[model samples]
Target: MTDTAVAAPTVREVVAALDARYPRSWAEQWDRVGPVLGDFDLPVETVLCVVDCVPETVEEAVAAGAGLIVAHHPLLLKGVSSVAPDTYKGRIVHRLIKADVALYVAHTNADVASPGVSDALAARLDLVMLRPLVPAAAGSPAEGEGRGAGRVGELAAPMRLADLATFAAGRLPATAAGVRAAGDPDRLIRTLAVCGGAGDSFLRDATAVGADAYLCADLRHHPASEHLAAGGPALLDVAHWASERPWLDEVAGWLRAQFGVTALVSDLDTDPWTVHAVSSNKENHL
Candidate 1:
């Protein structure tokens, strides 16, 4: 009997495909996206998908013998003086290089891709008629593909503001900061807007798009309160990590189906908040 070898995609090929799907040009001018570190010619057999490329996730990839890691967030978005391997980020870089693992980031580019971050989030809530909350500007790769920063859509059925918050809480990955909402709980919701991470910037866009309720993460005090005061849509805030984790599955599935690779999502929770305590005073405190 003759033996047949299964061919694997090279690091260059995988990064190319990712860039094609979520072009770097579509990302914000100040943002970093695309391949970060790796041997371009190395054959990639197994891939690990994660929301963040921290030390823990790097260890997970090394332990799994993953040739490549696709992360939603950048490992070194801010400028660093060096990769001395003693510092946290530096250690991650050295670890991956030693393990022969490559790291790629998809930040804002993935957020604006057609089946982007918020699309996965909306899928959890069973939203329909999905469209860009903030459509891309002219000449970008994602410009005319119904691709943009955040997403807006209609729910399968109308529900009260309270019910929608509860439903969203049940749908997203569990985090210490489970979920919180602001506005009249009894208000009805049919249209919804969602952004996967740190999406407070899109509050006005959600309102302009006529979303009855908006779901996202990292909602600060003044903007949230001012938006509500101005009669904006209802707001639902989830954990930053929880909001973006769903996209890992999407990318993992795509990698498997598209290239016949072994793609796995890391189960580690990267959200900073671990313990959430409820205030004893409840409504009386306010």
Candidate 2:
């Protein structure tokens, strides 16, 4: 008699498990979640996790031999009028389909989950006893009735703002841009608030919580200026993509341990802008 071993969970099954854990419906109304492509029946040999679904990240997924890519940000958030190759996002969509690579996003749902994006970020910075910063509004799941967003925590030892920034840049993926801060470099900080991406909206929460500093991404000029002027917490702005990249590793590790399937973390720097700055020495040399 020929023996035919039963197959384990396919890509679709794994995706379904993820969806059950973090329901797509729980995501913010504008978010684009769920599978982007590929057949559910196809066996998933390997998976890749990333922060963004940009062309570079897709390329990395292809190179990693990933059958599926689980990303933090949605590849298609808004309704697309067309899929012509002219547009950047369009081209990315085209490339993924051509490569037979599947995409799944867990945006705000993952953000609000316990031990989620914000929690991971806080852990990276060695923060302790983390709790919700904004403490999601009453009746919202994000209030930690089951989930929450934006974690606030205390540092094991308070450090100056500049020192904390240096620590963060070292712990996170090294980027040409490194880290940037807007506050008194010498200000000692203990209580800190962190949000994974585009966290300007939580400034008030951070201030109200009495956090000595707030770590997040996509801090606009006017808001940051106004917050500081209002005696708000010191702000440390990082690449939106970079700040959330650490969670990819955490997620990949979890999936690998949970399902026993090989998982890879995409190391693509999907941030659109590249840093180009001249040092004083370089200027003198020039």
Candidate 3:
């Protein structure tokens, strides 16, 4: 008896599948995404999906025998003079190249995808009747009924900011920083706005759309303060890692179904802020 091996999808075919779901044209002009490394003709039998393509995740991919790493963040955001093994990103590039593992990114393109980042977050928060906070341009790649940068939606019933924050902490992936809020704990919230990653940029849009609160990650102090000063929507901040982690499973499932690839979501916590220490002395010096 002869054993027959299953055929593997090439790097080009896997990337095509990803581009079909999150078209590269949907990415913002400033953003860099898509295939960053690897030969297009390389056969890919195993795929690893992750929010960030860090060294640990790279090692995890290598250990898992994954031929491709579908990362949410682009490894090279800016032009690099070299891919020398000494530099961090360079090291990553060299490692992937050495392992013959392909690296592909789907950043803002995935953000505006139909069942995109904000959509996944909204689902986690049990949001209903969702709509895009910033609607994609008509006839654009991401143009759809509920496709855009952020999402605005409603809960089953209005709740206090504290309650909502608690719900978010429980619902989101556990992380060191956990979930933090920057508004009245008792403030009533009904309509919610959410962007999976850093979302301070959308404060005005959330306010203009009449959202009661905005849930996102990487909220800066100045922006959060200014938004609250302007009486904009209340803020709920979470770990950047937790916010985008939800979409990994969805992407993996889609890849598995579409191309019969063995796709896995890396559960490693790649968020930079590891230990968050709270000061016992509450007196403000400033």
Candidate 4:
């Protein structure tokens, strides 16, 4: 008796699975999703999932012999006339091609997937009864029970606003910007809203839903202050990378189950902020 060999899937086959899971039509009009570069016919044995398609992740994928890199953020989001090696994004693109590593990006489309980025983040916090913070359009391709922009849910039990922030800091991946919260520290939080990436865009939506607190990344100072001043839910801002990194593991497990391939997550911290120091004005700890 002999055991059957595990089969590696071609780039096209894997791309089809990714697109089906996170439909390209769900992506924002200005966003890019799907395969960025790769030989569709080439077989991919290992896939590296990352939050960003930067030099560090590309290097990690190459060193690990990853045939394909599934990136949450697009390497080339804006228009560019040249991909000369001297340019930043160009260098990364060049490295991937040289090392025979194909690249795919699932940005906003992945965000809106039924069990997408925010779902992972919400899970990290042990939230329950999750629903979309911003539901998809009624007739859009993304329209469905689980398809939406962000997530709203209730913690297993209530905690103080400050404790909730600390709990989140501990739950999410470590980063220079761990977690920052703005609101009444002693306030009890139950219902919470979360968006994996930048979420200032949904502050009003969170408030509308009567969520006690909202957690996400990249909460700009102005928007955050105004939201709180307007009596919106408390805010917790984590590192942009830390917030979305959870989805990498979620998707990695998914790929393994769906395609039976070696899908790994890159732990490289690509959040840009390497050092963090708190104010000496008071004894502050997170």
Tens-digit per-residue lDDT, 45-124, candidate 3: 99999999999999999999999999999899989898899999999999999999999999999998879988989999
Model 1 C-alpha RMSD to native: 1.5
- In model 2, the runs with Cα more than 4 Å from the true position are 1-8, 85-87, 143-146, 278-286
Full-model lDDT, candidate 4 = 0.93
lDDT of 3 at 275: 96
Per-residue alpha-carbon lDDT of model 1 for 169-272, expressed as tens digits? 89999988999999999999999999999999999998999889899999999999999999999999999999999999999999999899999999799999
Q: What is the lDDT of residue 21 in candidate 4?
A: 89
TM-score of 1: 0.96
RMSD of each: 1.5, 3.3, 1.8, 2.7
Candidate 3: which stretches are off by over 4 Å? 1-6, 284-286
In candidate 1, the residue pairs with backbone N, CA or C atoms under 3 Å apart (3 or more residues apart, or in different chains) clash, namely none
TM per candidate comes to 0.96, 0.90, 0.95, 0.96
Evaluated against the true structure, the overall lDDT of model 1 is 0.93
**Ten residues in a row with the worst lDDT in model 4?**
277-286
Candidate 2 weakest lDDT stretch, 10 residues: 277-286
Clashing pairs in 4: none
On residues 97-119, what C-alpha lDDT tens digit does candidate 2 reach at each position? 78778888899988887768888
lDDT score at residue 64, model 3, on the 0-100 scale:
96
Q: All candidates' lDDT scores?
A: 0.93, 0.84, 0.93, 0.93
For model 4, how does the per-residue alpha-carbon lDDT over 4-26 read when each residue is reduced to its tens digit?
Answer: 98769999999999988888999
* lDDT score for residue 276 of model 2: 55
